[model samples]
Target: MKIASKLYRTGAFLAILLSSAGFTSCEKSLEEEAKTFINPDDFFTNETQCIQAVNGVYQTLYSIYSSPDYWRMVDLGTDVAYSIDVNSAVQNYEFGSGSNGTGSLWLNAYSGIKNANLVISRVAVAEIDNTIKQRILSEAKFLRALYYFNLSNTFGGVPLWTQEIDINAVSSLSRSSLADVRAQIIQDLTEAEMGLPLSYPSSDIGRVTKGAAQALLAKVYLFGKDWKNAKATALKVVNSGSYSLMTNYDQLFDVNTGFKNNKESIFEVQYLREPTSNTNTRTHSQISYYIPQRDAGKRTYAGVDFGNLVVDGWSVFLPTAKLVSMFEPGDKRKDIVLGFGFRDQKFTRFPKPGYPWFGSKFWDLNANGQSSGKNLYLLRYADVLLMLSEAENELGNTAESIRWMNMIRVRAGLPELAASTTRAEITNKIFNERAIEFVGEFQRRFDLNRWGKLIEAAKSVAVDNPVGAAKVKPFHQYYPIAQEEIIKNPNLEQNEGY
Candidate 1:
């Protein structure tokens, strides 16, 4: 009944949004039927409709990444983050096909992939401007690659779908090998780079760009252990002259500063609460989940009450003691990353040891005290620098790696590394730097797994928390394919140790 395009909903294409108000337009474009849906024959008649179609792909990211279960899947069971909730706490080390988060992530990714595939397969021949058509197709390709990248990283090898599939007609589907998936992801991103623009106007700010494609490609290479390409691609973004570290580290995550598409961000999912819609939805619950629980009556932290810092929160996602101590001396990032303790980075300290240390990077108070319109960064300039540092070190370019590492170090108020640093030493330093830099961004588990250090890292700190110990296992490296998906497609097999 309603057409919800991802780009159209972010206030980028208000014209398209208004046109979707009528049923005829909705029926002609992206309509989902019970068994067989309408083909793209009538949908790709114009550029506006094509844009509306692509927006549906973007909408899938919100349900995937913004869910509470998604964060729990990545951070809760790791050394840096702990979950107070029982179900979430169990995910730190153990996850199965039944995991709600796994199902949501898989379903959301494929849903996005389906939409992306539709756009890529049909929008090119539309009677739209050649440039606009290519850009739309490029964005669709980038998004499809993103879904596959996440799939491969999480499930090792997932069923690769490049073209739209008819659910009723396709009775069975098989998973692709991880190698094939990685190759396809790389191919998609490389092809996407050509059509993507270097930048966009303020209204079109959230659209994928050349830098975003490169950044994602670099990450894919990093995950695949392609050090040469990883360093090269990451360096491309660093030297592109399009991005820079925010002068103030704290402002990088501050929602109030109007820093949504700042120079540091390569790509981010844009969310809006105003101009709100019911069927075509917009909003996220991250703020309410991340806000620390505190009492206004008792001065527990910073000689102040917790309610003073946030309206209220789920009180989950507490930081581990190991994470608190990992920060280097004189590092400003430590204070910026954690809250509910002797906090000096962005807020007052908690003098009393009453409240758990919660992630403060996404701390934005909303009017309803629930969802906040804070945009989450999928790729940032800081991450590019760190990736380059890691990639160069892996390539045996120790001096070159330190050069990049020092850039992030200097920004966090830490001393620069010596050029004589060893590969082992620089790798550890880079790992620690990323942990501090990207806290509360849900990056730790992936980094550890990619580096082959997840099991060991979990083992080393398992003694600290029995709950964490219960969750950590070698089989936990990749999550199982959701049971629902397996049932829908018998070709789907569960991951090992599930």
Candidate 2:
């Protein structure tokens, strides 16, 4: 799950605002060039234009994650993974009094939310074809809900803005009650599910689908501890037949394969290597940053050579020893999940001595020494399965719980967990599995917090790492709301103990 951070700079938000305003005019001009330009009020006169507008919404979604603060902060803040020295400031918890707090995950998520709001507000009033208009609005709603889901999870109750709010008119906004925020999220997702199609054509694979909406709704319900609703929505996705678990677990993240379009993927941040069309290319795909070999010649696009891995400076993400130990011995997923090694112990098979980073499997080390970029998978079928098992166990459905848990374990080449397993036992197993499965995919902190184990976990592990010992406090569970935001919005009360 993504979190909010102070990292969103005012300049970046201003840039987006200017760009969106400019696009409105550019779009008008382009339409006129082809004798297709309609009046501002008349622009959404047809389905094609409305659909194009919806595509713009997705474009915004794609751009948000590419920001440095969002991915970096999320990867480092979590417990399942750690960043190496290369990107240590955030990973090492050494984030100082910078313009933004720590990294900028917080600001970027809100920026995405703001952009979604712009789309929803503008598109709703446009005179577009009804079906297309509704669909576009639904997509915007889904994206907005996703952004809020990340925010609510990270910061608890946050300022809930439905339509676009005028910054000048509203200098201060208070955090809404968590209940109210969750209600809005459910409402947005519910609308999205009704409007979205069960699936999309191959060309539209990365766009949000009905299954994606439902899966996300299930997650929202699960986090809110609405067990029945979570179970029901998850089952809807499963029974809809819109997705299936990939036959090979490893294939879900295989760079060579079109992992973004894989069967198991429900929602993914889409990035393309070479773009012939404007819609397909990405500027900040993960492969460019994570791939180790700087001089590897085979290039689909110009890859950034960060010069010899600046061990502490550039290679920021590293796997923690605790995470390494969590993997059961002989588990095939252990190697695939954490690259070739277990903790600091180097693997004789695949060794990189200087910087033993966490996410090696995500690299596309081809025989020709070329690599396809790394695309992050935010939601997948396996996650849903694990969630389903979690909800079932919480609801006291022992048989159903075992069935789901075993499904994932069986796929990972592990024996089925027995039905007699206690809820605590099953929960631990599921949590461990999630850690390994999602290791550097950026999901550790959320898992620990949701399990109510972050403080304890951090303290226990502090014996080896001093930062963990010193910084592990109850308040650390929720990231501090940026001080600037508080000054601007007096309604925003600081989280207790912050």
Candidate 3:
């Protein structure tokens, strides 16, 4: 009950960055006041406040992922998801340094990192029990590492800050090398894995755990092309006995199925449909952008009254036909993942004209368009298994790789591949499997970039939406630094091409 009381107020910490009060060097009175103000140092004196402080960092995640513009930055214009709106800057890849989508994501990520740094730096001497202190510190590290991981992937070696920055020193900071960023991320996650517990009580289900840190470390390794470390860390999670695949694939994202924080979830951004107060970020969550516009009780379509799963959505990101064809003939995941061409025509009443393939992963019958409480999974057990397979094959362990890959395939109701399969074949199979399994989950663009296939994939899917693809060049592997940010900090440089 107390956690609920404090959790809703956690989002108030965002005011540290969002406040409109200008910081000016000429205002000596204000600068002196800022120095004496009771900040995280004075605020986190007790356990309850420490819990609230960490909750603030978690609150930043809602703003990071829930924005429709965020989805446009990551998923839209990719091979798996497309939008027809040529005027949409992000979808069409015509956005320049002034793009708000890129700027918001950049600022939101740093805001989270800044809050986590406050916790990590202040909680050390907070007069709490050693166990509780370690837990809080580990959680902070896990979150900070996550923010940096996303930053490095998106903008490539963004400014790295492990401690709070004074307003006067903000513009002096410059970008760190990618290698340096990766080193810090690995160090933070390694410490997190050591300090985090394997599991928590039901009340603390969404908190980061030992498995989550290890799973994310494995992903970081995979991104850096360190196959040996990637496999080692991934297998650590697989053999840890902490997670298992849910029996039914569809239940993973089905809000009606009561599987929001199931065994498969390693890390998730927790959201609730109903908030305890007006300030709570729980009610701020939104996944409606994935739904079809007129379908699901929004209006009559194809002369049929399709019932609402969630109403009045924009259907901005529709599934691509190429993604629909990637699934094998007998894979059950296809039916659950894509609602486009099903025999019952569940996703859309008319698939011929719009060819809408809306995501069925996050549906709740009781939801209004914006208040859906579906948790956005950051890491899952299935992703771990697939990554393990990928790392194993890269290290010449084709047999072991197939064994790991088969676990996922068997659960998907498809026949397993042969153990005698070559390394290249198994690697490609795992790649394609990830493409289909995690299509609507915001992993496509990053996956393609890490695999060094972004340019090729964009070209291949050019015909799907020519106007958008024509603007996607090889330089687009990294988004340009926002003009606002560059103007604020002269040290910040734009990526190669605007």
Q: Cα RMSDs of all predictions?
A: 5.2, 7.0, 3.6
TM-score of each: 0.87, 0.81, 0.90
The ten-residue window of minimal lDDT in model 2 covers 1-10
lDDT at residue 292 of model 2 (Cα atoms): 36
Q: List runs of model 3 lying over 4 Å from the truth.
A: 1-6, 13-38, 100-103, 274-281, 284-287, 295-310, 341-356
lDDT of 3 by residue, 106-130 (tens): 8778878877877787788789888
Q: Write the per-residue lDDT of candidate 1 for residues 386-461, one digit (tens) a residue.
A: 9999988988989889998999989989899987889999988977887778877768889999888887666655
Ranking by TM-score: 3, 1, 2
Give lDDT: candidate 3, residue 458: 68
- Which wins on lDDT, candidate 1 or candidate 2? 1
**Which of 1 and 2 is ahead in TM-score?**
1
Candidate 1 regions with alpha-carbon error over 4 angstroms: 1-39, 92-94, 100-103, 169-171, 274-281, 296-310, 340-356
Clashing residue pairs for model 3: 296-308
For 443-465, candidate 2 gives per-residue lDDT tens digits of: 66777777787766655545234
